[model samples]
Target chain A: MIGVLLLTIRELRAKKIILGLFGVATLVWVVLALALRLDVIEGSLAGARLFGEEMSGDSDLTDELGEPALGNSLLETFVFGAEMFAAGAAYWVGILLALFATGGLIASMLQQGQVDLLLTKPLSRSKILAGRLLGVSVVMLALLTYLLGAVWLVMSIKTGIWNPRFLLAISVVFVMFMVLYSLISLTSVWTGSTPLSLILTFGLLFASLILAIKPLHEQITQPGRSIVVGLYNILPKFVDVGAHIVPQLVVGETVESWFPFVSSLAFGVVAYALAFRLFQRKDF
Target chain B: MPASAISVKGLSKTYNSAFGKQEVHALRPLDLTVNEGEIFGLLGPNGAGKTTLVKLLLGIVHPTEGSGELFGISIRSPEARKAVGFLPENHRFPEFLTGRETLDLYARMSGTTDMDRANKSEELLERVRLTGSAHRRVKTYSKGMMQRLGIAQALMSNPKLVFLDEPTDGVDPVGRREIRDLLLELKAEGVTLFLNSHLLSEIERVCTRVAILKEGRLVREGTVEELTTQDRIWRLRSTPIPDQSLGDHAHLVSDAQSNGLSEYRLHAADRTALNASLDHLRLAGVEIESVEPLRQSLEELFIDVVEDAST
Candidate 1:
């Protein structure tokens, strides 16, 4: 397993997925660093927004909306906004890129000439497949860490605000990828087609995001609710999980209990189990 | 002591295709034993179950019926493959890895570690004449180079038995000779080799034993000399043919006056009679050039076996 992991790591590195992820992160960070400026001028929170080096607006806390703020504090607003962008734009784009990049690991590995070499090894097929999954998981985690960490750093360095809560997106995004990537692997194993795997996994992710609405959950009848609940139980709640991190980062408040994490983990375990079972029995 | 490095009894494989609408019997129930430390060649036409047999031995594909043992271990057990290495036909290695890295990866897969993996990888790369290109990515390698690297990968573990399918398929003549020499070196170390190839001449030169598989069954199996040799036939080429060709002891295979020399294929009842006929030729004052036992080339034997099975 370690040997397989080591080779997988080499494969990811050589394929330039790692470098490409870092490049996207760096580009995002540079843009964020230039556009937003947060400062404490004369004991009042002031923010300067720039549009291509031209100051678009200068807002002092008392001057922007009213004398007294009604909703979130300036610090909460800044942190919340940064985390949301990270989740909405950075995280979503990263997942799409990962779908395009890492989706082929299983499909390509299972090709006739390719699988024959690995299957003939002294290890069981399950271990080989698990190693591949864990390898991609590790790469996804590294990419998430770099992209999230860069955003956190730029936010802190530019705005002089450091919220450790933003770092939680790293784990949340990783879990989200795990849940979706499991289906990716399962589909790849079944079809042995990378394009089909990508389409199915991406479609499932989009569907999950739409179904995560609380209003949508409330409107469904008993049987409809049962089917929706069954799907929610097995698939990751992408929008819920991604959007949930914003409020958590802002108020440091926990929401939605442990159901989301448990269900996603269950989804991953079930998908992986199904994939392993099918892969073991596959003729190669 | 174990009798064979590889032993299979009534092993078979049948797969369903077209959504299980059709049954394809890839291999029929067959028994085979490859004795220890001999180069055994599996010769056949395309789709002749040669690769299927190798896959069955490696446990890459499950056998529908019967069992196989590698070095006394059940083929169904992973431990049976612990000391076994295989190079499948039209194999594709991880193209991103360099030649050395590829060997190291495959060596590590066989459970080699640390210093041993490094040493064995370097040794194999050099053995396959890829020492200079060890650091080059496999994507940069030519087809022949990839084939050599495949050889290095198979030998990484210093496996006791190695199955090579089309070991020199895309290799040039020089590379083929080098691969042949490498196989001989492996044999010298007492490694049992199961070679599957359509290259009859290559198999003829190196294989101590050969099996001809037609369709899904083993039609013939024996030593190369045994399979190619035809009994009761002698090829004679000599000058100045006698009008009556050694009486009825010999029969002409072709016209005697076709060339300056007359060629005759003689079928004598025994060695005594064959020597007597040769002695008669000499006494008749016909200048004798050469007399040799008639034998079929591996190609001829393979074609005959497959054609016979088809008919």
Candidate 2:
């Protein structure tokens, strides 16, 4: 097992495409977080001033006022800004990062015949597949760590009060990314081609998200509410994790929902095991 | 002496294809044995089942019928594989790894744990003359370099027997000579080499014994001298002697004049009769310049075997 792991690490180091993609992913996450922080600052200051004026019962704070008063403390504004950024950008970043990293890792190995080389070794087929999965998982974790640290640093400079719950949200987001990456890795092996694997992974994610939204949309006087609800039950509700985490962090609400986490982990493990078995049976 | 390095009895293989399931009896129930410390050559033309035999020995492809043993272990058993090293024809390796790394990986996989795999890798690289470029990626290496690396990897585990399929297929003249020398060195070290190649000159030069296959059947098998001796041919050159004055039993095979010299090849039943005929010609005042037996070249022998089998 260690031999397979060392060999996998060596192969990954030799591949420039994976390294370049990871670098680009890190840069994009940092930039998005920074931009989101700015928007949150602007939006929060405007919202707080509107609320304070209404509470003060000032006649001059009329309904016709185009601009609301700026908030008093920069720290309060920054925390509000960071929370807003997490709600809007976290899911998209997680999904894309998972897809790109997992897809690129599998494709690069296949294209270079690395898997063939590793299998020719004395190591078992399962160990080789597991080593690759482990490597990709580590890379995802590292990138998530970097992104979380960057976001917290930017937000900390703007806001005095540091929220540990924001860090916890990032950790949950990393776990979600890992589940998605495992699915993509398995699909890449199953499909045996890069473009096709990426397409299937993205297609499944999109389908799941769309299905999760149908129940809410159908309740607004739409027909086929039962069918939408059935789909909502069948498809994975990945967005619920983010929705649940963000609200608990911002509103101080402790909600319990471990089903999605357990289900995603279970699916990921089974997919990985199946992919490894198929790969072992394949001639090349 | 107790056990043959390799033993194959009645080994045969058939392929099922889309064109009406054409069956090719590759081995044709052949029997073969190679003793320890001998260089055995499997000489044949294209589609002669040499590669099939090697694949069977390596357990890459299953045999349709018959069985063999390597180093006293059954061919089907995985334990038997530990004693065999194979350099497949047109074999491919991962292009991402360096030459040194390639050898190290194979050595480790072959169950050489906690040992000096790196040292073995370096030694083998130097043996194949790829030491200087050991760190360069395989993709950047030339064809000859790749072949050298392939040979190095095959020898990494120090197996009891090595199966090399066209080991010098794309090598240059110098590289071919070097590889031939290496095979001889390995043979001297008591390692059995199962060499499969169409290059009869190589087989003739290094093989202690050889077997020829045609269309998946063993057409001929013996020492180089034995195979060459099966067919008789002799070339004679002498001064002009009138055909009417020639002694009895002097049938001319070919008579030609080159640079004012006459050359004639004669067909005789035996060496004594040939000598008698040569003496009679000399006594008849036909000055003899050179009289020598023209043994069959390996190429000629190979062509004759394959062509005869086809017919």
Candidate 3:
């Protein structure tokens, strides 16, 4: 299992896409740091500028009102807005790109020659599969941490509004990606075709989006409504998760509900269990 | 008593296609044993259960019936492979990894210590004459180089048994000889070798015992000499035989050469009769140049076996 982990780490490093994600993360921080020029008058946000223009909050920051008119709440609100955008982008785009990058790995590992070499080692089938998934998860978690961690630092330092709850979005995004990964793994095992696996995974992904629409749930007639709602309960709640979880965690608002997150997690667990069983019983 | 390296009893496999329709019996019940310090070879046509047997032993595929053991450990247990190494026929190492990295990774997975992996990998690289290309990625290596590197990987664990499938398939003559010598050295160290190859001549040269499989059944198994010997017949190269002494025992197989030697196919009812004919020729003053038992080559025997089974 450790050997499989090393091999996967080397493979991902050679591919260089992870390096691009890190670079994107750094760029986000650099742009945030430069764009928000803050004037600290006696340890208060006396003035703030957005790309060389006066930043306007609910009221105003620097003009017409009085001395040091900008309240810390306005600053917190501004930082919260920036952090939410970063969280949403990292959750949506980052997870999508990560799935694209790793979707083929399980299928490739199951190819005839490679699987023969791996299974012949003194490791059990379960350990080998666990090792492969661990490798992917470790790399993805690191990338997400770097991106979200940098963004959080930049926003907090510039506005002096540090909401540690924002860090929870990192796990939120990471777990969501893993939840989706279980589906890809099952697809890869069932059909050893990488393209077919990715297509099916993406197909379920789009279906989840359609299912997340509340209007679709209401408009459907009785029998069809039961089927669509059942489907919604079964699939990963991708769009609902985007709206409820990461954004709420970023803005320091009360999460709408934990049912969506827990149910999606249950979906992931079942998918992973099915994938492992099939992989263990498969004949190269 | 010598320890048994491998023991199989009534082991079998049947592959079910998608939807569980159209089942193919890849292996019938097989009962065999391979002793330590012997080079055992498996011979067969395509789809003859050779690869299936190897995979079953390695636990890459589950057996449908019966069981096997490696060095007293059940093949069904992953620990049975702790001291086993395998070089597959068409192995593919990740192209991104250099030869050295490939060895270290696989050796680590085989549960070798870091120190052992380092020393054995370096040592086997030099042994296979790939020390110079150790740092080069596998994709850049030639087919012959890949084969040599594979042999090195198989040896990194210092295994008690090694299964080599087509070990010399793509090697040039010199490289083939090197692999042959390496295999001999492993055998000298008391490593049990199970070889599966289409190269009957190589198998003939190296294997102490060979088994021929046809249609998922073991059709033939024996030592090379035992399998190929022609019964009650001998080839004699000698000086001119007196026609009277030749009697009905010898048939002329070649015309007399300038050196005055000719070959004859000598028939005998038994060893006593064979010696009697030779003694008769000696009395007639015909000098014996050489005499030996006649036998078929392994290739000829393999073809006959496969064709006979088909019939």
Candidate 4:
């Protein structure tokens, strides 16, 4: 398995598309770093504004009312807003990109001529499956770390507020992806078709998000509610899990309660275990 | 005293199509044994269960009935493959990896020790005549170069038994001869080889024993000498034939005249009687120029076996 993992890592290193994703990520960070600027003001608390683009020569930092305004620190507000975008918009896009990038890994491995070389080795089917999973996971983890760390660095340099908790978002997004990728891996093993695996996993992802809504949960009958709740519990709570990251950073939310984390971890474990079983029994 | 390298009994395989709409019996119940330190060849027509049988022994496909063993270990277990090396037909490696990296990957996968891995990698690269191209990516290699690299990696572990399917399929004449020499060298080191190829002449040149299959059944199994020998025809060449005194054992032929020399085709019941006739001719002053056994080529034997099975 370790040998497989090492070789898998080598394979990922040569994938031009994955490197292009990393470049896009860095480009996004660079644009964000240059476009947004925030600073401290001694006179009016109302001067708290995140300036986007150039405001020109003589515009007052304060509003026309000339009264002290909403918040004290402009930097905290800016960091808070950026965290939301990172967690919501950027994270979801990253998930979609990952699905597109790694969707064919298992399917490609199972190709007629390719699978024969791998299966003829001295390793068990389960180990080979696990190693491939880990290889993709490590690549994703490296990408997330780079993007999150860049965001942290840019925010700290501009705002002088280095929030250590901001880094947790990397792991949060990675875990969310792991939970989703497990479903993709299982689908790949079951069908050996990349498009089918992608469609099924993405379909279940939207269904899980819709089921988590409180109003929608209320609209269903008692039996339907039970089924919805059961599925929500079993599937990784992607929206909820990603939504919780920003509050913890900007608002000092406690990590004491772990619902989606534990449940999602369990869901990923079960999916991979089932995938391993299927891969072991498969003739290819 | 050599031990059995592979032992199979009643091994079989049957594949079912989606929804059970169709069924294909890829292999029937078959029995086979391959001894250590010998090259065993498997010859078959298309869809004759040759690849299926190799996959079953390698545990790539599960057997539907019966069992097999490799080096006294159960074929169903992964450990049974620990000392085995295989070069699959139409095999593919990761295109991004270089020749050296590909060999390193297989060596590591085979769990070779650190010292032996380094030494063996270099040795194999030289043996396969790819030492100069070891650093080039496989995507840049020609088909013949890729086949050479494939063989190099298959021998990386210095395994006790190696299975090669169409190993020289795309190699040129010179490259094919080099591969044959390499196989013979490995045989000298007591490594067993299981070869499957369509090139009957190549098999005849290197294989110690061969098995021919047709429609999932073993049609013929024997040494090259046993299968191709035409025992009744003893070809004898002499200076001239003044052959009346040689008794009824000699059949003089007018068509045997060539370049003022007499070439006689003698028919005998068996090799012992053939040798007796040759001795009698020697004392009678009919100078013998050459004595040789006339036999069919491996191609002819293979065609005969497969066509006979079809009928």
True contacts kept of 3: 0.74
Better of 2 and 3 by TM-score: 3
> Candidate 1 — which residues are off by over 4 angstroms?
A30-36, A41-73, A153-162, A213-233, B1-3, B235-249, B253-264, B268-293
Q: Where does candidate 4 clash, by residue pair?
A: A46-A69
How high a TM-score does candidate 4 get?
0.86
Model 3: runs farther than 4 Å from truth?
Answer: A40-45, A59-72, B244-249, B279-286
Candidate 1 or 3, higher TM-score?
3
Best by TM-score: 3
Evaluated on CA atoms against the true complex, candidate 3 attains a DockQ of 0.73
Question: Which residue pairs show backbone clashes in model 3?
Answer: none
TM-score of chain A of 4: 0.84
- TM-score (chain B) for candidate 1 is 0.91
- Per-residue lDDT, model 1, residue A276, is 94
Candidate 2: segments with Cα more than 4 A from true spot: A21-120, A127-192, A213-270, B7-34, B43-49, B59-69, B73-79, B91-96, B113-115, B212-222, B231-295
lDDT of each: 0.82, 0.69, 0.89, 0.82
C-alpha TM-score for every candidate:
0.87, 0.69, 0.94, 0.86
lDDT string for model 2 (B192-274, tens) is 99999878899999998899988888888988888876434566677776787565555455464674447676667888878
lDDT string for model 3 (A197-279, tens) is 88887888899889988999999999999999999988889888888778776766667787778888999999999999998
Evaluate candidate 4 by giving its C-alpha RMSD to the native, one decimal.
Answer: 5.0
| Candidate 3 lDDT over residue span B178-209, tens digit each | 99999999999989999999989899999999
lDDT of 4 by residue, A29-55 (tens): 898787765544542122333335433
